[model samples]
Target: MTCDEQTFTMKPGEFQALGTGEIAYVKPMTSDDLTTLFPQAPRMRPGLNLWVLLNADGTPIMLSDSRETALANAAEHQLHTVALH
Candidate 1:
């Protein structure tokens, strides 16, 4: 029979067919797989005296006299911020 019309029967010691039509591309994933799929969180950098918000790539994105302002700037630009020591 053709693939589309094939009938599968599993015997007592046999392994059932796994990848059929829609499930042909399905596979199990590990923790690493999920991590790779999502990607690591962006890195945040603090200015020389904790006076600025830097991008993940270490580029200065905002400069403010206070930490709150810097965090606000990051928020306004839709960026996640983390405190860097």
Candidate 2:
């Protein structure tokens, strides 16, 4: 450690709460992954590319064929998006 270096610690709960409502996650998905992550989604053709906007806690908010649409939806809901992987 150096004089200019600093460290901050947070409890597990606090860390998890960091982006409760203000942040969301954007994940790219294949049709195969859709059924598992979004059971409510309508059946679609196999091997389709898709994007999903999820809350900070991994709850699906919206699904779209276009990543832009997912991101736009997140912004519409006042959420900042982050890449999941």
Per-residue lDDT for 1-85 in model 2, tens only? 9999999999988887788789998888899889898887788888999988888877788889999999899999999987655
Candidate 2: stretches off by over 4 Å: 1-17
lDDT of 1 by residue, 1-85 (tens): 6778978777743343322111211122333333233355233342223354555544445444466776666667666655445
Give candidate 2's root-mean-square deviation (CA, Å).
2.6
lDDT of 2: 0.87
Note the Cα lDDT for every prediction shown: 0.44, 0.87
lDDT of 2 at 48: 94
Please provide TM-scores, in order, for all candidate models, with all chains considered together: 0.39, 0.76
Top TM-score hit = 2
Model 1 ranges off by over 4 Å: 1-50
